[model samples]
Target: MTKQTDSMSKQVETNKNAGSEHPPVKEHYKDSLEGSENNSEGFLAEVKAVKRFWSPVWIVPILCVFIGLWIIYEHYSSLGPQVTLTTSTAEGIEAGKTRIKTRNVDVGIVESVELSDDFSQVILTARLSDGKEDFLRTDSAFWVVRPQIDKSGISGLGTILSGPYIELLPGVSKESNNTFALLDAPPIAAPDAKGLRIFLESDEYGQLAAGDPVLFRGYQVGTVETSAFNHETKKMKYQLFINSPLDNLITENVRFWKDSGVNVDVSAQGIRFEMSSLATLFSGGVSFDVPKGWSAGQKVANNTSFRLFNNRTNILEREFKEFDPYVILVSESIRGLEPGAPVEFRGIRLGTVIEAPMNINDEQIVKNDNLVIPILIHIEPARFTELLGEQFNVVEQYEKGNIKGLRASLKAANLLTGAVFIDLDFYPDDILVQEKQTFANYRVLPTVSGGIAQIQQKVMLTLDKINKLPVENFIQEATGTLETSKETLVALNDTLHSVNQLLSNQSTQELPAVMKTTLHELNTTLEGLQPGSQGYSSSVQTLQRLEQTLRELQPLLQTLNQKSNALIFEAPATVDPVPKAAKP
Candidate 1:
């Protein structure tokens, strides 16, 4: 260690001499430090002066702030208006999932659903699209669309798969709104839909519902929107819509009828069947038509009212006018006459029977001098107003008692049915007019006796002839006459016997020859009167005269047995009649 120390000391001395020759290490380091300091100080001064506010720190912070603000603005701008809707219930709805649609296009979403304060209805809060704020209005209608099957028809079929949705039919209002009442059911037709609205009045309110078609000339032109019964009016009111130009067909005089089904009519011509369409068969409909030879009248205004007929035939002859009443007095039985029996004028319908035959309950019956049946008939002159000009007045003629030869008669309408009707005819044969007396507010018109009356009069005449016969006196006279004739016949026979005896007595031999000559002359006369000769015709006439004389005598014999014609002729008896007080 000592030797090393001595060597080091010698080296140290040498090194010291070397350090003195070179500059000291501290001095060199100090010079280098000064030069570096000078350069750093200048560079530091230049950089400090050139510095600006656009540094990366400032730029990064500013960018971060701008991005945050943009994000916040986008979040706020994307939000939409909130709307509240009241519904009967919130069935088939989810707050976030339920969508509001217009024509199947999403317009809004349900933000929340809760019960109302009264708990009577469900309140729903929805967020509508940004620009759709104007769509929410006082008149806009909203309803929850779900799977529905009803009498009207099936609807919301898409809701079965995609879930329930709120449907909105926008209104025509220009004002904006945020709250709305939900509809329990969809409208038959949108209130703002393009159409013309009209009303119909009917006595019968048929089973008609919303969406029922309205037909014109068998083509569907519109729909029935609603129907209600009016208690005060005792009529059914139907609200309807006719789309577009089809409404132009409606007029004041147009007639509407319920299209129930096929109509069949059996008339003199043939059977007629009318049908609108098959759709009308299932769903009830209304049909309209205008009568021929009539103007269409004024255009149908909004909610114009019309009467609804049950069928087409009823509307054909619906108009009727008042009539004048007349009473017909009949002497014959009016068994088959009844109220509503037609009163005809020469095979033309003129009136109807209002009251059938009944016993007269007034002094007129006593004056009539016959058991009379009074029939009341109503005559409507308007039915024949065209045929009978305005100057022809029935009342004036009746008052004048001339009625223009109009007279009433009873005639058989149906022989088998025993039905009869009043027949008014112009009785030219009996035109002597007489004053008509009023009875029961009706003019008393004379009725002519029918065919049956003539038979009755003839029977009465025959009965009178039979009653005039003096049958008892004729029989008594005939018996006396026959007795007298019997006595005369016996006396004549005795005379004939006496003559025979005298001729047989003596002096007849020569007389017999003379008698033969006379007989020969008689035979010659007989031969001349044979057939094919004028003498034969004269002989026949003589025989006829003798037979007529015999017939005259025979009446006396007939008077002895029969009494029918005893009083018809005067009978002369050969002997005096028996005394009234003669013995038995």
Candidate 2:
């Protein structure tokens, strides 16, 4: 373009001169392009010059200082070093928002949940406050406290949804890497983390939840951590976190059952136990009591078997496989019983039953194509054991020796529902009172012990009594008396026949007249002898006696004459009329 301008140089020079004259327009045009390369270079140079004069090296240091301060603040204020706490109670506990507090001061944050190496306890990871280095103790007790209930009594079931608070019991052990145990509340027992995991099954009343109390002799000894259903076994599984101190108290003889009332059946003795109370109306719990003397202590009964019973269902479970009252294994027969059908022990209510889920029994019985529930019965071992014997004093006083007063009882079992009852002083004469169903082949139970054995003996004695009565002698005596009465009637009938024959014979009738004359003569002689019989007075006496004798004969003749007249004449038939109707 420049070369082309050569020819036009002269023109261009003239144009340039013109352009110079119009410098304002060119400048204005250039100025319109505010971002022109030349202007941009000049602006850059000016900026460089100003920077060379006034730029500050101190600014970088200041900024660095500020950034460091900010980093320090973040490090100090943010959640601290990560820590983990394991507790028995997940109750009253929440994640993320839960805080681990030491003397009411926030110490750490719950990070996450993890499984312990032993697989016994739940591990909760937490980030402790940066400055808080010491809080956990080796012997620090940990428990998750929520609303709970057990053998000891009913308590909170309230803390489940609420967040958990960590209570740090500062310890003196200086080990840097401490076993930071969890303390949800006061510990029931020191955690013996023996790596033992056990389960229990119970109903709403019988169930044990996390943070619920576990007790021995009414003293809290452990807590519940988690509850679940075991699909493999098909029963409920509740984990009991035991304290190290009281865990050993559980003995082979230590049996567990539900706290709610149920009917218990003692089948052989025909005894039933049914005790009801208001507490048993709704919720249930677990309870236990040792026999008066039968104990399984002195050695560890750790692997001992436990029995589960449901009085309501009348089911007895042989094994409580990790379950207390929850593991009641009902026989299929009892399992089929309807709800509200009572279970009785010697005529008393031991419990009532309900429909339930599958159980841990390897051999589960099915009926009617429906599931067989694991029957659960609520029982307070303490309360249940108290009723076996009566206060004998009352019975003793009731029996007065005067009339050979016999106080006997007959134990009977309900035929329809299998409940049992005791009939005190029942009269055997009333056969209707006894159950009609009887054993085809009756074999006595192990007549073991006191009043029960006496009852059995009495029953047998009654059987023998019917065999000793005298039926044949009474029959023979009745026959002899009937024979004698028959003879007497026959003799009387023969005598009447003879009299009729005499009346029919004319000659015999004449003989009757002669007998009458003889009787009159004898009467006259007797009267004369009794009156005066001297020679001179004899004649007079004879006359007088004759008159007296005639008078007596006259009365006899009159009677005979009347009888003859009646025989000769039939009496007239006449009807007696009612008195004339009163003047109507």
Candidate 3:
């Protein structure tokens, strides 16, 4: 066999060198037989098995395996992180269709939507794009974005046509998370926004809500991020964010008050109308500022707690710290006096009414016959500091005033509203009590009956006095006098009737003609005395003659007097005296 193989190999090499396809089978067999005969010692044929490193059949399977590996790498490389999202409701979410976005940029898609184990919530498995896994921080927020109209105004309007999607707000926390709870509403402020966060507590919830604007001097500077009510504390707590530089304005002494947009103040001064803005008018907001007479204190840090007042006036009322408390025992009814009533000194507010008609048990009421209603009031020394100096001691001043007959009385503040306030003034007429008085542990400030109560009391006293009088007897006497006057009047009427009858007689009627004839004769007689009439002219001539006669008689009378004197004794005629010069 070896000799045959060598002969065949030699024949194949000769064919290959000749560049021929093959040798004839008969010639190849003859050559092989001749080579075998030439080998005298016929070698044992050694049959060696041959093996191949590879085969053509393996090409298809290897190509298929490579293709599968490439496909698997591509599938895994393209996939991002998977996160589980939980929400109360699956309102707008859909499996494989819903997308997650941040700042309106698509970032992920919901792979599946399923119910929680208790079926109380919707769970969504969302797949984010490559490298977006970093956004899944512990504090990250997620919510559905849809058309919403709220107190803040219209938002998510674009989602109306684009369809609802999950909104993701990346948090600042370094810790990563794969599961998160969905928010019902979008956050008021961006997580990364520069601002200050604060907490406010209020006794009442008021009308404030999340997304409400926070105003500084009527200008928006922040927003209400969250609002929650505590069942245990019974207070409404609010989380607020003041933007950037505006946050610097917040101080320890600053006040926060609810802005119901429109402020209508019906005070003793007058009705004042104030509005923050048109936007706030429809949607209520909050306002902050340092209250009047208060100093802006140090800047507040994050999460600082503060009190939220109902209104600006309430904040001002609470700003004073240095004050003294006293009680006023009022005998009159305190119908219009309420807590927070102004305690004024001659129309200037010096204090606030802490309580009207202090709480008293039935036993106390029964024990005291003349039970005067006790009014608790706080007199702030700060109010008088400007006038009485900062060193003024409220208690000292109160004691001094008490000794000098300073008293409190209820006065009508607004007649239309029937509101009353405590008035402080000196009333010397009130019975003086030298001893200090106290009621319910509070120093008593003497009170006097004044205002409407005094008037009512006086009226009641007058009515009582009148009631005590003999009114029936007075009425009877008045009736008797009236009857007598009626009789007198009847007699006067009879006299008048008789006079009328006398005037109505015929002679009485003809008296006018007789009087007229007399008047005519008198006129003729009077005309004779006139200068232009005969009587007047005669009188004038007679007077002239009388004057001439008197003039002629004057000389005769003088002569007669002189002759009579001469006859009585040697009548001497007086000679005319001549002027003479003074003797030298």
Q: Report, for all candidates in order, the number of backbone clashes.
A: 0, 47, 2
> Ten residues in a row with the worst lDDT in model 1?
40-49
The residue pairs found clashing in candidate 3 are 528-535, 566-571
- What is the per-residue lDDT of model 2 for residues 474-543, given as tens digits with 9 covering 90 to 100? 7799899899989999999999999898789999769878999999999887776663555448777788
* Better candidate number, 1 or 2, judged by TM-score: 1
lDDT by residue (1-584, candidate 1, tens digit) is 34433544464466567765323433443454455575533311111124366666788889999999999999789877888998787888899999999998999999998987888998899998888877778778898888888766798898789998999888778887888888767776676777789988887766566778898878989988778999999988998989988889998878888887677754322356887678788766888889765679988678788888777765653344678878887778887777767777666666778788644565465445776777888877765665676445454465575555667888777765667778877676766654456776667776687655666689999999988999889999999999999999999999999999888877775788889999999999888888977899988999999999999989668786666556776555558678688688
**Could you say which candidate leads in TM-score?**
3
User: Per-candidate TM vs. native?
Assistant: 0.47, 0.34, 0.67
Ten consecutive residues with minimal summed lDDT in candidate 2?
A: 439-448
**Candidate number achieving the greatest lDDT relative to the actual structure:** 3
Report the error of model 1 at residue 407, Å.
8.5
Model 1 lDDT, residue 365, Cα:
55
> Which parts of model 1 have CA positions greater than 4 angstroms off?
1-97, 109-131, 137-139, 148-155, 174-193, 264-273, 319-584
Deviating ranges (above 4 Å) for candidate 3: 1-78, 150-158, 267-272, 319-322, 361-368, 390-395, 398-402, 462-584
Error of 2 at 336 (Å): 11
Question: What is the lDDT for 52 in model 2?
Answer: 57
Predicted candidate 3 versus true structure: per-residue lDDT over 1-584, tens digit per residue: 76567766786667768876433634666656676776776642332324689989999999999999999999999999999998889997888888999988989999999998899998999999999978999978999888998765788898787789999999888899999998889888887899999999988866588888899888899999898999999999999999998899999889898888789877543466777766578878889998776779899899999999877877767757677888888777888777888888877778888887777664243214786777788988777776667554434665765346677788888877778888887766664653467766778777777688878988999999989999999999999999999999999999999999999999999999999999999998887777688778888899999999999988768877768664357656679999999999
